[model samples]
Target: MAKFPIDFLWGGATSASQYEGGHNEGGRGLSHMDFIRRIEKSDKDKVFPINVTKKMFDDHKTHENEYNFPFRRGSDFYHRYKEDIALLAEMGFKTFRLSISWSRLFPTGLEKTPCEEGVQFYHNVFQECRKYDIEPLVTMIHYDIPVYLTESMNGWEDPKMIELFVHYTKFLIDEYKDEVKYWITFNEINMIMNSSYLGGGMFVECSDKPAETCIHQALHHQLIASALTVKYFHENSKDGLVGNMIARLQNYPYTCSSKDVLATQQQNQFNYFPTDIQVKGYYPASILNYYRKNNIDIDWYPNYEEILKEGTVDFASISYYHTAVISSEPDKQEPIGAFIRNLENPYNEITSWGWGIDPTGLRITLNDMTDRYGVPIFIVENGLAAHDQITKDLKIHDEYRIEYIKAHLRAIKEAIGDGCDVMGYTSWGCIDLVSCGDAQMTKRYGYVYVDADDKGNGTYKRYPKDSFYWYRNVIKDNGADI
Candidate 1:
């Protein structure tokens, strides 16, 4: 049988904001994610951005941390990255993917002088990974943006955000370029389709500017930010690969009908068009037509064409979750089901969160991305999140998780066999951390399980589950025998 390339990296990924508890550690201040979690748990039925009642903060009857799920002081990776890296090393991982908290590096989000403590913290973390022979892959911005920036400037909607992000990124490159090799401009930059607040989508929502105008403006800023990041790092740094990540949620026609096919096409267009402009150096005609139909014309600045031409990425990075179904229906206008057809896939087992478990979707994503853009694709995040149970033997017998990963690996192998230019694999949330979309500890996806309760109370112990060993061997064998 064919095998995973000898140099193929096999490792797990986690983000600073998710796993690195010490939420208040390393000079890292509370981010928008903190506020987001606070409101979501207190009153489940309340629409987001509702008033944070004094009762919400002071109510002793509610869970500690004023939120139901555990986030602040998660697995305590700030204190235990060494041990975690050791565990990953034992698993034969060649690479480790993580994100640098913007707040950690720039405590207030706009600070000119970098925080010494935050810089020192990641410095130690990277140094430890280097010692263990694991190549460090860093993402500049994960889901956590500085709350100060969000509240004061309304997040990425402000053009100032592009500059701030670039400044923060430059600091990271100057500090760690000699050590770290792989970098992504923003994690899932295209997730504006889901919630604008999370992925520069709020830039449009909270703008005094027209909604379409702000969206296009935000897109321009993000594209410029990503391109500028690549241009600067490539020219200035010693050597590194820079790309933007799309949470590449693949989709299929619900049926073979023309409408279904059209739905998938439109849905993929919505998800991919913005990033395509960044990676391919120009917006597709279809996307321009999309904006025109909506009465939204993006303002293109002078020298914009030149910047894109000179600064397109060297690669495309993606996080493949599960594929969705798209059905064409013009009249549907609810917030969740409005844009695309995210119908249930009867063929696969779904998690409690209702995300389907279709490994084949991953392979399909790689193939489609390669065929469309003709650039190397990186699987930055892929995995299963489920409600895990710890057995009496003090082990998380997550065989189901192992099976989920194995099936996805198999799909990846098939994609490789079909000659897709694949780079590497880094499953999301390598060590159990808070979920980005759900903000729950119970939605656990980690090789080494952290002994923490959903209510945010536990010794914060780490235990290697069965999949941990399974993945170790998979990496060791290079996916030939998995």
Candidate 2:
């Protein structure tokens, strides 16, 4: 087996909203994620509802049900960081990719001073990682925006959010400059186009402006905020590497027809436009054409061009879960709740959640990203979400998870061999936590299992699964043992 680089960071990725359970502790205020409740739906209905309306928000806010909100209490990582970091250290994690809760620090987006207790909580978490000699890759803002921002100004739709987000980023960089060296400005930034409610906290039904107008305007504000944050981090922090995170959903032509190929190209362009602007520090001509064709006008400031140029990211980071197929045919059966319409691929196996398993897609994405932008690429999020069964003996076999990871790792190694400047791979949800898709706990994606269920009934005890030992060995051998 080909050995990985000695300094390759082998670790896992997690977000604060999905893992941390102390929603009300340490002076934490409600976030947009806190306002979102997991709705009951049939298996036919997608795991998460993509189209959120103002009516749904209104009903959910006043609803009498208590358990509708699943993320209110995540896997309890807030109180279990010590135990979790110990497990990560045992697995030989060289780095741990996690996000800082923006709401935790500035309870409300307009706060001039941060919550001291909330600041101390993250300080303690970073201290724990230091004790284990694990490098922390902290994301400045995940999907958890301050609920007050959305309620008051309709999230990023208002240009004022750019200033507020920059303030929050400055505070974090100033306080944690010594502890965190790797920073990501946003999580899946392009999702703002498709999942505006969850990604940008913009409620379309509540906005007086057109939905498309609001979405694009919010996206512009976020882009500005991201660039400003990157520029500030490099200027203030010592030796900090700031990057942009995007959902690297690779698209394949469903058929050999030219139309299918064109469709795939267009879809891929939409996915890459955000990263292109962030990395290249300017809008691509294709994106400008797209805006004109759609009649979407962004509110650009006088210094916006210079801001982007100065704020270009040092590297590019992506979250790769599954690949999608695109076809030009109008009658294609579209996947439910997918950001892009996808045709079923006959060559790949489907997961329980209707995602296609394509390890080679990982290599394709890595190569494509490297070829487009000559910067180090990081696989910040990649893992399988399956129905893991724990036997009566209190052990989870999970050979399937090991197999999934091994195939992906082999694909990554091939990408490295193909001259892709890959940085490291961080498997998503290294420890069991709340699922972002369905907000369910049963969708397990961790090597270490947590005793929790969808209804939040469990001791929250952490246990090492069979894949845990296998991963430890793989790390011990530096990715050669697998």
The global Cα lDDT (0 to 1) of model 2 is: 0.86
Instruction: List, residue by residue over 1-482, the lDDT tens digit for candidate 1.
Output: 54677788788888876788787876887765555443244312223222222243234234554455344656788898899889888988889999888887787787899889988988898899999899998888886778788768767677787788889888888889988998888887766545556666254444677865675677677788777788898888767888778777677777798977876787778778756877788878887787788777566755877877777887888887777776666553223212223467688777656677888888888788888888888888989887788888878889888889999989888888888878889988888987765566777899888888666778788888888888988887889875
Cα TM-score of candidate 2: 0.97
Model 1: how large is the Cα RMSD against the reference?
A: 3.7
Write candidate 2's Cα lDDT for 1-482 as tens digits: 45577888899999999899899998999888876776555433443435456677777777736536778888899999999999999999989999999999999889999999989998998999999999999988888898899889889898999999999999999999999989999999888777778888878767777777788788888999999998888899878899999988888888899988888888788889889999999989987888798788777866999999999999999998888888777787343224544466789887777777899999999999999999999999999888888888899999988999999998998898888888899999999988887677888999999998888888999989999999999888888754
Candidate 1, superposed: residue stretches over 4 Å from native: 38-65, 201-205, 210-213, 330-342
